[model samples]
Every structure is written in C-alpha cells, then in structure tokens.
Target: MMTIRRRKTRKRRSPQKKRSRRRRSTKRGSQVKRRRRQAMTHRKKRRVKRRKKEIQTRRKRTLKEKVKLLVINLKMILLLKLKKELRVPQKTRQLQKNQPQKSQQLKNLPLLSQLPKNLPLKQTRFQQQKLRPTKSKPLFLLAKPRPQHRLQPQ
Candidate 1:
C-alpha cells in the first residue's frame, strides 16, 4: 500500500550563513597552501639524504680499489728485490772467470785507439750517440740491480 504525504518545503538560508561559508572557504585555501609547502620540504629532505648515501658508497668503492693497487705495487717491488739479491752472487762468480779476457782486451785498447777514425757523414757529430745505451732506470724499479741488462719476467 502506498501512503501519500505532503513534502516539506525548502526554506531560504540567512545572509549570516552564506557569509560564514565564504569565510571557511577562504581559510581552507591557506590550509591547502601550508600542506603543499610541508610536502615539498619533505620531498627535498628525502632527495638530499639519498644523494649523500650514493656519494658515500662511491667513495668507499674508490678507496678499496686504491688499496688493492697499492698492495700489488708493493708485491712487485718485493719480488724484484728478492730476485736481484739472489742473482748477485751468481753474477759476481761469472765476472771472476772473465777477468783475464777483459784485461787482455784492455791491453789491446791502445792498439785500437791508433786506428783511423771514420769521416762524419751528412749527420751531426753528436747524433749517433743516441743509439748508445743509457744508464737510467724507471722509477718503479729503484731497488733493482746496478746496470740492469734485461730484467725480463720469466
């Protein structure tokens, strides 16, 4: 069964109510701005923290690699020193046997000095000296033997 009832009629709001609503809406705009500012600050802080962590990790990796290279260089220097120390006695013993022959050659030096010199060609006088051996050694092999002939790694 359907019962028919008379509907309640709408009443018009007062001017004060409309004014209060406008006031609340204006206040809400400022509140929205404050919330957005807080969110922006939080995001910036998080990004800065992330960047710091990445930089620290990079520094650690670089430090580890540097330590490894330093260790390798030290090992190479130690090995070179050990090899030179062991080989020195053997070389001195060999030089003992060659002394007589070297003295004979030294005696013949006077006769060789009497030979006529070749005339210089189109090149400069000092230019041919570049092909001669040098006494300098590399910085890394400072503890190596004197007059290093050839320290080829076996």
Candidate 2:
C-alpha cells in the first residue's frame, strides 16, 4: 500500500482586490466623519437659536417696562398740570368765602353814607384806558415845537 499525503489549498486573490477593499473602507470612514461633523454643527445651531430666543424675550420685557414707565410718567405729569390749573379757582373761591358780608353790604349804602367811589372809579378808568389801543404816530414824522420852547431863546 502507498502512503497518502494531504495537500494544503492556496488562498487566491485578484490584483485589484486590495485596492477595491481600501477604497470601500475609506468611503465608510469619510461617511462616519461627515455624520459626526454634521451632528456638532447642529448642536451649535440649536445653542445659537436658544440664545437668540432668550435675548428676544429680554428685549420684550425691557420694552414693556419702558412703556409702563412712560405711561406712569405721563399720568403724573397730567395730574400735576391739572392740579396747577385748579389752584387759581380754588384760591378765588376761598377768598370769596372769607370776605365779610357786612363790609360788602356797607359799600351798597346810600351815596352820602358810603365812602367816595371816585378813587375806585378812577382806577377802573385807568385800567380800561390801559387796555385800549392808543393812536400811534407814524415813525417818520418830526415833532411840532412846544409853545414854551418857542418862547425860550434858540
């Protein structure tokens, strides 16, 4: 009987096999890297959006506060102006209330019994004359000589 020997099978590979395998692996690595970069960029964008929202809310709050303050200030100013306008009437009414009725009645007594009304009438006439517009001379006219100055030596 002859001795039988087992033969080892050789592994077979094409020339382009290594290059194709390397290209496929490189493509997968690049895809993974791109996904990671995109995820980072997305997170950054979300953070920026959140910050912008916060800033917008803050601005809105500040604007509302300013408007509220403006309204309050306007109300206060109106109240002060109204109070000022009211003061004169209030003082006049108070003065009217404080006057003595007897004194007022005395003024309406007979002309002989009452004090002379000439001074008050004169004052009122003066006031009326002051209120009236006086006839103004034209600015270009020369003045006439007075009689007293004419009598005097030149």
Candidate 3:
C-alpha cells in the first residue's frame, strides 16, 4: 500500500515583502508606520499639484511673451516701411514751406493779440454776489407725477 502525504499551506513568517519594514513589538507601531507612509504619499501628491500649477503659469507667460514679440516684430516692419516711404525729408520740407503759416497770418493783424481797455469790466463784488443763490427755499421741477388709473377687468 502506498502512503498519501497531505500538504498543509501556512503563511510565511519571514519579513521580505515591500511592506515588511515593521518591528513586531506592538500593533500601534504598525499603525504609525502606515500613517507615515500615508503622510509621505500625501506630501508627494501636494508637490505634484504645486508643480502642475507652476507649469500652467509658465505656459501662460510664454504665450503672452510670444504675443508681445509678434507685436514688436510687426511694429519694426511697419517702421521700416514708413522709413522707406519718407526717404527724402528735404523735398517734403520745401513743399511744406510753400503753405502759409498760421503764425504769419496772426502777425499781420497785431490788434487781435492785445485788447483795448475800453471794454466794460464787471465789478468783482457784484460778480461774486451773482454766483451764489440767496434763496433758502429749495427749487423743484414744474412737472408733477400723473395719478395712475385703476386697471378695469373688461
């Protein structure tokens, strides 16, 4: 007769797994280790969140800088085109000399610059009195609010 041997499966007592960094003194120590691992994971998550925010702000600033550079390039090109159009300043200045100057027109009529003292000047006391209203009563609008008619059910 052949003897059939039964195999009993048992948990391994040796600490070799990734989560085996614990002393076998008490359960509280194990809980402390778990809490530490949780805190480390949370800290890493917060750091990742901060890094994402920094990346977003950097992207926005880069976009704004790109727009500013494009605007500057456009302004430079337009300035170059304008410089080419106004290549000769001397001829334009000579043409402008032909037009009558505003100061030259005013120079012919000297009477307009200085006024004669014969014009009537208001007295300062009367002018000051007219500026302020002496009436204590409040002035109101002439228009009065019309009475509203009652809505009738036809």
Candidate 4:
C-alpha cells in the first residue's frame, strides 16, 4: 500500500520543461553592422591569445616546484660543505706526519754520512752531472734510461 502511494506521488510531480529544436538565424544586416561584428570577433581572438600566453607563463613553474628545487640545491651545498669539513682533519694529520719525518731525516743526515763518504768520489760526481741532463728530457721518456751513445752537450 505504501509503494502504491509513493508511485502516485511520483506521477503527480510537474513535467520537465522541453527545449526548442528550431535552428536560430543570424541577421544579414547593413555593411556597418557586418563591420562591427567582424571587429568584435577580432577583439575576442586577441583576448584569447593574451589569456593563452598568461596560462603558459603560469604553467612554467608553480611555487611548490620552486621550493622543491631550492631545497635540493641547499641539500647539495650542505653535503659539499660536510665533505670539506670531514677532509680537513685528515689533510692536517697527514701534513703533521710528513713534517716530523722530514725533520728527522735532516737530523739523521750527519750520523748516516759515513756510508756516503765511502762511495767512489768520481762515481758520485758523474751521478750529479747525469741528473742535470735528465731534467731536460721529456717526462714520458724518463721511464726508460736514455742511451749512452745519444748523450748531448748543453
């Protein structure tokens, strides 16, 4: 019985409005009217072009993307700084070790001088002269000893 009453209520509702299907016609008016219509269409086209340019500029980058890029750049800079900070102590330690070794070698020179003195005097003089010529050779050719026959005077 309730279903029957609901169906009756639905039937009693007002009919929906219907749209007209007739084709609308534009007026073929005076030459002045035609010119005015053409001008309006041109203005509309220009406005649409301007709107498209604005949309393109807005699409290039939103504020959120700009912030993300800034964050990434900051992170990279911080990482580079951290790497430099970590390397500094190691470099200082290496310099400290090398300084002591150089000083100790210089101090031991007088004590270890006996072995060098026993070596042939002419042999040591020849070695010193050879070192002067070797400095003039190209770096790549230094791995192999130069031929004795090709020795040239400066």
Candidate 5:
C-alpha cells in the first residue's frame, strides 16, 4: 500500500549536461569581455584623433599670430619712415625762419619772389604782346558746304 501511494519520480540530470551548461556560461562571459575590449580600443582611437585636431588648431593659430605681428611691424616701419620725411621738411623750414633780417628782406622782395600774390603793377611782356594787334588775313572762312548724299535713303 505504501508503494502504491508513492509519488511519480523525476529523472536526474547527467554530468555531461551540467558540463555543457557551464561551458555555455563561460562562452557568454568571454563574449562580454571581447565587447569591453572593443569599446576600450574605440575610445583610445577617438582620444588620439581629438588630440591631433587640438595640435593642428594650435599650430594654425600660432601661424596667424606670427603673420599679424609681421604686418604690424611693417606698418610701424612705414610710419617711422613717413614721420622722418615730414620732420626733415619741418626742420628745414625752421632753419629758414631762424636766418638774419637781410636774407628775409631779400626773400620778401617782389622781383625776387618765386610765387606771385597779386596782379603786377607794370605790364608784363606777355601783356604788351597781347595789347599790340597784328595785321594778318583770316585763316578760315565762316561757311558750310551742302552734303552730297543728303537725298539718299537710310
């Protein structure tokens, strides 16, 4: 009666099945490790690229700054040369002003002056020539000729 009342038994798993399950778990762990390694390599490559870009940018900026400095230096040199030219003329004018009274009087004389301020008191050679009229025949006649093709069509 005890045997008749016994519950149905279930089969036990084999050692080979347990071993295969363990192998599958290890394979999955190795796959996870491979993925982690791939991610690390990708990150390293990106970092190297970013660093190279940063270096390139720095080089370009430095080159631009050098060019700008060169232009500024050139401008400063030009300005210095212009200032020297202007100063020489100013100094010459000052030296002329410092001369004695006799030279100043000579410079102020009407006949000796290179620049004229107003109309002359006496008639010049040009004015005398203009005032005298010459007796000569006219070079051209005041007349127009009729066009030969005036009646032609356009």
Candidate 6:
C-alpha cells in the first residue's frame, strides 16, 4: 500500500483595498479626525441649504420682476393704441376747429389722465358708509324686552 499524503487547505488573505478619503476620515480615523470630518460635512450641508434658499428667493423675485415688466409693457402698448386712435384726420381737424363748444365739453369730461394718480378704483369711504344701516345699535340690541311671564300664579 502506497503511503497517502494528506493535503492541508489554507485560506488565502485578500489584498488590503484602499479606503476613500471620506470613509477613511470618518470611519477608521481617530476620534478627532472623525469629529472634524463630521463638522465639515455639517457645515457643507448648511451651506448647501442656504444656497438653495437663496436660489429659491431669487427665482421668486425674478418672477415678480417679470410680471411687473409685463404689466409695464402692456400699459405702454395700451397708451400707444390710444394715441393712434386719438389721431385726427385733416377733415376731422377742420370740423373740430369749427366746434369750439364740443372741444370745451370734451375737455370738461373726466378722463383717466385728468384723475388723481392715487384715486381709489373701488367705492369711496363716503359711498361705503351709505350702504350701512343708519342705526348705531344692532337690531338685536334695539329689540324691546318681553314682559316676564308669572312663573307661579299669584
């Protein structure tokens, strides 16, 4: 009988893989290094949050500015159209020259340009006051007290 040799199986150790800077700094690092890394990450996260808020505010402001510009452009276009329509032909100009009374009447008519810039478009304070009841007290407060019924027959 040939002597049987027993083969021993050994486990192979894998090569050490290099850890990333972040992982090394945070995980396997000393307490001070990990704390520093955590602080830095916290600061970066705060900066990112602040930047996002600022960007959002900028976007809102830009939207409002765009709307204001659009309103201004619309007003300008309306003024241009009004100017075009107001242009008088030579024949109409001659006719208007003959009618001074009509021109005076037109001048007296209340136009948007003639109105005060700060004038309220809604109902005036005086008009609004008229809509309210004239009485100072409410209806419930002014109601006459009913005679107390006798709880027990005297």
Candidate RMSDs in Å, in order, are 16.4, 20.4, 19.6, 18.4, 22.9, 20.3
Higher-scoring candidate on lDDT, 1 or 5: 5
Q: Flag the better candidate by TM-score, 1 or 2.
A: 1
Tens-digit per-residue lDDT, 48-141, candidate 5: 9999999999999999999999999999999999998877887787886787776575465445243333323456697655545443311111
Tens digit of per-residue lDDT, candidate 6, span 1-154: 9989989797654455334223644444487798999999999999999999999999999999999999999999999988876886778878977877855755665555644444333555975564444446432332333334632366
Looking at model 2, which ten-residue stretch has the lowest summed lDDT? 137-146
What clash pairs does model 1 have? none
TM per prediction: 0.47, 0.39, 0.40, 0.33, 0.43, 0.39
The window of 10 residues in a row where model 1 has the poorest summed lDDT is 137-146
Candidate 1 per-residue lDDT over residues 56-94, each given as its tens digit: 999999999999999999999999999988878977978
TM-score of 1: 0.47
Cα lDDT listed for each candidate:
0.68, 0.68, 0.67, 0.63, 0.68, 0.68
Which lDDT value does model 2 have at 119?
28
* Candidate 4: regions farther than 4 A off: 1-28, 31-46, 49-66, 90-143, 149-154
TM-score of 6: 0.39
The best candidate in terms of lDDT = 5
Q: Write the per-residue lDDT of candidate 4 for residues 85-136, one digit (tens) a residue.
A: 8878977968876776755755654343343332323335756555443535
Q: Can you write out model 3's per-residue Cα lDDT over 62-104, one digit (the tens) per residue?
A: 9999999999999999999899778958888788789789678
User: On residues 1-154, what C-alpha lDDT tens digit does candidate 2 reach at each position?
Assistant: 9978879797677778755655444578788999999999999999999999999999999999999999999999999998978776877878979887866765654563243322222235755455453335321121222345535587
For candidate 3, give the lDDT: 0.67
List candidate 1 segments past 4 Å from native. Answer: 1-26, 90-154
